[model samples]
Target: MTRTLVDPYSVPDELRPYLQEVVQRTHALCGSDLVSVIAVGSVALGDYRHGRSDVDVTVVVDGTAPGPVVPELAAALAHPALPCPAAGLELVVYDRNFTARPSGEAGYLLDINTGPLLPERASVDPSESPAFWYVIDRSVALQAGRVLYGRPAREVIAEPARADVLTALRASVREHSSGEGHLADNRVLNGCRSVQFCRTGRWQAKRRAAEAVAASEERFRPLLRAALHSYERPSRTAATTLPTTDVHTFLAWVAERVDESSDADRRG
Candidate 1:
């Protein structure tokens, strides 16, 4: 059953039609089991630069849905004509029951990832990566997440503990800090945003966060500027101009700062 596709609300024009189809398809396939479809990450925040950001989403399903729903949604999303914009689609689907009681459960039924790094894949089991938790946490799923169907975003996801968010941020910094080339730029800019969020309980768009931190902090200006440039031209490593050694140094510094902040948060 193919659901009709219409322009989705609050979605960027580039991916709206495609995402609309994807969401509708999921609805048709899952029927009564479907709970909600949500847009998250850069797309939800309105900072999705064409050719640079991936379309990220979260779909919720009632617990009674059959186990095969994972693969079904993956197949529903893989439209040949509507190829994933930059970096492909990063999607996660959760069971309504699991989300309602997030403390003990692994929080998702399907984790579908497809992009430059790997072919389209869907895992029925939860991922060990901090990113999985990053999405499940309220920061991405509730604060920035936009509902495409069903319940309101806040009702679909639980408000995560502050400690959980801090833990995820620290782990993300540790993992991304080792990246080089274009990834180095991502690590730097994302580090600034994560740090800013940790310091002040507010979340801002990546480039805006970098600009705000650079303007007030002077020391991070050059690196943040280079990161913003690299973010725009992700394919051109040379355009970043910052040496690999410098990127590593900056990453290490950012990691240390995040650790210190996390420790302080825990203590306080």
Candidate 2:
């Protein structure tokens, strides 16, 4: 089955051919075990901007697929001939069983991100961290993502519960709370999305989520605008350059909001 969230005509013409080629190559590599290839992230959310967004993809495979499939698939897709669109490609390959009920262990067989500086691969080992799962469980993965092959996205994905959402947010906050290192612009916006989801029950792309919260939460406006500006720009260097102090402040606020939301949920 094929399911598309956005009209093919709507996507910038230049991106369409490249994205199609990527999908075709992916289908060729995964073969029969591939249950579905869904497009998540900004592209599916109608917020796609040519140079600013990454083309995110999720390839679901049969639970029983061979162990070598993932590594092989990764190598195959990582070929230099196949150029990526936007900032880069963010791809995750998940087993069907894992999609239904993700475990503490890394549910994905292959998780990779590729861009200019990191052209060949991105070392996002989900086994080492649960943050990957937190980002995957966002409602947009199922509700708005485009299915390029096999089963429809809705049939393949199991949306996380409210409790699960809170857990994920808390984990993210803890991981990023240390002020020693700076936070990426996307992480800041992701925090906004999580907080918004807890309070409003709406899933949004980063830009929209940041905008929504900035409008309502006066304290976050300047920070959110900074992030938004960075996100709109084409280069990583153009991204937000917040100081360590601001980064810590934002993370601490997110942690507090998450704690309060979780408490409210429990009390209710």
Candidate 3:
């Protein structure tokens, strides 16, 4: 359950082989251009659930890989060819330059989203997309990313600024507040995680963060419990749909919590 370098034990038993395949494929395909492939998110945090979680990977390239390699990488790791074993594979490719500098702005070369739960689309061109997702992801990757291939993550992926991560977490709270996120489980769990990060400066697995928040924030216990159930048992039916009004309310509370922490940091 330890989130360490190439820790296969943390990855669900069903996903270990497929994740290995991803690492092998990237090494064979990208060759020298591929500097490191780091496993981030649930798998890295030891909270991955079969059929529920996506295999999140961050690939760091040598920064010298040409534009042609982008398309080539896109084709090689595309779903049908690679066939992700988890719900989906959330793969992002970045250059060494992108990871070397520690900043608030997020940058990437390619974002390949494929699998059963995800749409089969390869998004390139960082300019077209908002930096929110990348910024949040990079923060988590720096904290918990485990190497799947090539060098160790910390050797390449620089730690993002603390203030930038707080900003990204605030953006996540705003997203859930607007009711625009794709997953209900994520909305609930991420809200808890964001508050924990805002207050503690620690990034934790969603379930653990929810549990900790629920323990101390008794008012949120029922909602956090429902969120945990949905995340741990994705295929099973929940007793009740997460109430939208309640969700918005929780997010509003989260925004305030984050704001309080941000204000505290400024004062201290």
Best by TM-score: 3
Q: Candidate 1: lDDT over CA atoms?
A: 0.70
TM-score of 3: 0.92
Write the candidate numbers in order of decreasing TM-score.
3, 1, 2
Using all chains and alpha carbons, the TM-scores for the candidates as numbered come to 0.87, 0.84, 0.92
User: Model 2: per-residue lDDT, tens digit, 84-186?
Assistant: 6576777887778877763334466677767553456644356554653535443567778776666877787777666766777788667666533333676
RMSD list, candidates in order: 2.9, 3.3, 3.4
Model 2 spans with C-alpha error above 4 angstroms: 1-7, 10-12, 102-105, 119-126, 131-138, 176-184
Candidate 2 at residue 10, lDDT?
41
Q: Stretches of candidate 3 above 4 Å error? A: 1-7, 236-240
Backbone clashes in candidate 3 total 0
Residue 174, candidate 1: Cα error in Å is: 1.0
Q: lDDT of each prediction vs. the true structure?
A: 0.70, 0.69, 0.79
Lowest summed lDDT window (length 10), candidate 3: 1-10
lDDT of 1 by residue, 1-268 (tens): 5543332657887777667777777887788888888887887777887767777888888885686766777776763434665567877777887776434234567877776643667777665544534443446767887777777668868766666666677777667765632366777778777867777876677888888778877766787888888888844334455567766776677677768877887788
- Candidates sorted on lDDT, descending: 3, 1, 2
